[model samples]
Target: MNDSAIDYAAVFQALPGMVALLTPGLVIADVNEEFLRAAGRKREQVVGRLLFDVFPENPNDPAATGMRNLKASLQRVMATGERDAMALQRYDVEDPERPGHWQERYWSPCNAPVLDPGGEVVLLVHRVEEVTELIRARGGRSTGRAQGLEAELYSRARELQELNERLRRAHAREREVALALQEAMLPASRQVGNHRAAVRYRPAVGALNVCGDWYDLVDLVGGHRLGVSVGDVVGHGLAAAGVMGQLRSALSATSRVADGPAQALDVLGRYAHVVDGAESATAVTTFIDFDRHTITYSSAGHPPPVLVHPDGRVEFLDRATDPPLDARPDPIRRPEAGTAFTGGATLALYTDGLVERRREDIDTGLARLADSLRRHRAADPETLADAVLLELLPPGGATDDTALIIVRL
Candidate 1:
C-alpha cells in the first residue's frame, strides 16, 4: 500500500505495545489503545492534559522517584533531539474505582524527540513495556538491595528443591528394600492341613516409610493343626517392620510349643516385653483344628476375626480381650474363643488397617467388612480376600499397611 493510503492513525492504535505522543512541553497529545488500557483512563481524561497532571507522583510515598525520572528523560530527549532510554521504573497509577488508591506498576520506557525543519523539538514519541508481572514474580523487589536478595532467594530455592529430590530418591530405595523384606517374611498361599490358605498384603499409598503389618500361616507339630496369625505394629519405618518380623517369628515358634491360641498369644506377649520397640503391637492368633472342625482364636488389642459359614452366616469373634502386647511387664493372658466350622466355611483374619478407616469408627468398618464377606461368601479363599480388599480399601483408599488371611475349610 502507498504511504498516503496506509492510515497511520489506525496503525498507531493497532500497535501491540503501549505507544504515545507528547508535545515538547510534556503534554499528552495522543495515546494508543494499549496505553489507554494500561493507564486505566479515557482519551478525554488524558489527551491535551499535561503528562504529569494525568499521572502525578504518588503523594503518599515520599520516596517515589517515577515522576522525577520520567521528567528528566523527557528533558534529555528535548535537549538532544534524539532518543533517550530510562531505567526500569515503578510508576503507580491511580485506581479508577477508588480515587485515593494507587495501583503499582513497572515499566521500561523510551523517549524519542521529533524535530521540525528548524532542528527544534516538536513532539516526543514515547513507548513503554510493562514489567509489573515479571517484577512481582521475581519477588517484587524494587530497592537497590533487592537484586542481591532476589538472587540469594532464587539460589536457596534451587538448592532446597535439589535436596528434596535426593531425599525422595533415597527414601524410595529404602521403601523398596523394606517392602522386599516384608514380602520375604510372608508365607505363600498353600494347603495347610485340609484347608486352602491365602494371604493378601497391601502397603499404604505413597508411604515411602515401612509399616508393621504382617500375616502368616504355619503348620503345627501335628500335621492336622494349622496356625494363622495377623498383626500390626504401632509405628512406621524400618523399626516397625523389624518389630513385625520379630513378632511373626516369635508367633511361629511359640505356636509349635503352645497347645492353644491363648497359650501361644500369652507366650508371645511375654516375649514382646523383652524386645525393644515391640510394645503396643496388636495381633490375632488362630488355631485351625482340621480333625475337630473348630477354630480357636485369641485377640491382643486387635480387630476381631470374621467367620463366614457355608450357609452365608457371618460371625465376628468380638469377645473380651487383653491389652496389646508389651502393654505391661506382665500382660494378662488373653482368653481364646472357639467356634464350630463346617465344610466349605471360610475364616478371615485381618489387621485393623484392612477395615479401619481414618474418619470412620472401627465398629462401622467392621460392619462393612462383615457385609462384604457375606456378599462374597461363596468365593474361593483368594478371590474372597481380593473382593474384600476391593470393597474395603479401593485404589488409594488404604492409609496404613493391610494384612489379611483367608482360610477355607
Candidate 2:
C-alpha cells in the first residue's frame, strides 16, 4: 500500500477517544466516526461546515459570550503553540436515521498544530473526546429514587466534615509551630556585658496559647552601654505574638543606631505609630544607660517599673512621660532621670496584668509586687521574678497576659 493511501479506518478503530481536525476559521476539516455518532449527523452534514453552524445554539446560551471567549483562547493556543483543553459542552440533536430518537453530545478540545512537509503550520488538530455516556451518568434524571439515599448522603457529609476538621487541625498546628519559633528567638538568658544578669519568664495560663509579653537585653557597641526593654502587645494569639517580635527586634535595631536611651525609645515610638490599626496598637518601652548613669523610658499604657534598693526599700520608677507606641503622631514623651542611685539598684519592669487584679485594685497589685520584692530581697533577679509570679499570680492563673524584666545596677 502507498504511504498516501492512509489507513484512516484502522486509526479511528484503535483510537482511545474521539478526534477531529479543523481549519483556523473553525470549519470542520475531518472528524472521526465517534463525532458523527455523538452529534447524530452524517459525515457529509458536519464536514466542510463551520462547527458553530452544526452546533447552532451554544450550550452556554444565557452566557453567549463564552463562544467568543473560547475562540480567543484558541487563538492563544495557535500563537503560543500550546495545547488547550476545554470542559464538557452538552447538546441534544435529533437523529435523522432513527426517528423520534435523540443524541447527547459532549466535546472537549485537545489542541495540536499540524505541520506540513516543510514544517509550516497547515491546520489545527483537536482530538475531541465525545463523553456522552459519562455526561449521562453525571446528569441527574427527573425521576427515580436512589437506593439508601439518606445513608449514602449522610456518609458523604460526614466525610466532608472530617476532612474540614483535619484541615483546621493542620492550620492550628502550623500556628503553634510558628509561635514556638518566635518564643525560641526571644532572650532566654539575661546578660549585661561583664555584669552578671538573670531573667525569669512565665506565660499567662488562662490567656491564649500565645502572649504578647516580651523582654530583651541587647549588648551595645560599648560594653558599658546595654539596652533593656519590656513590652506587651495589645492582644493575644499569633498576630500579637508576631507584632511583639517585630517591635522587640525593631527596638534592638534602633538602640544600636541611637546614642542614648531617650533617643532610642523616641525612634521606636515614631516608627510604631505608623503601624496603625490593630497591628500597631501600643507597646511600653524603656531604655537604661548604665554607663552614663541616666535612665530614659516610654510607656504605651504599660505598667510602670518597680525600683528596689539594697536597703530593702521599694519604689515605682519614674512614671511614663509619653503615650504608647502608635498612639498618636507625636506620641513619644522623653523619660528623664528621676533618682540617682550609685551602690546597687533594681529596675523591675512588668506588664499590666501582673499588677492588676479583677477583684483587687491596680494599687493593690503594685503593693503586692513591691512587698514580694522586699521580702525576697536576698534572692537573685531570676529568683525574685519567680517569687513575684508565685505570690501575685492567682492560683488559677492570670486572666490577661503578663511579662516582666528586672535589671540591676
- Where does candidate 1 stray beyond 4 Å? 1-141
TM-score of 2: 0.55
Residue 70's lDDT within candidate 2 is 44
State the lDDT of candidate 2 residue by residue for 1-409, as single tens digits.
8867988777755666666677767788888777676566789998999977765544433323324434544554553344667544444444677755545444555677665553334577767665444434444532344434534544554464456456557756966875685567578755665444566555554234566777788777764666777777777766677777777888889878776656777777777765533344455555556766655565555677777888988877656545566666654456644455444677787777688754456887888889998888778777877888888764435556777777767
Candidate 2 at 112: error in angstroms? 73
Best-fitting candidate, scored by TM-score:
1
Worst 10 residues of 2 by lDDT: 60-69
lDDT string for model 1 (210-321, tens) is 5788888878877588888899987777888888899999999998899888889999999988888887898888888888898888888898889898888998887746
Model 1 TM-score, all chains together: 0.65
lDDT accuracy of residue 220 in candidate 2 = 72
How displaced is residue 183 in candidate 2, in Å?
3.3
Error of 2 at 409 (Å): 2.4
Which residue pairs show backbone clashes in model 2?
273-326, 300-324
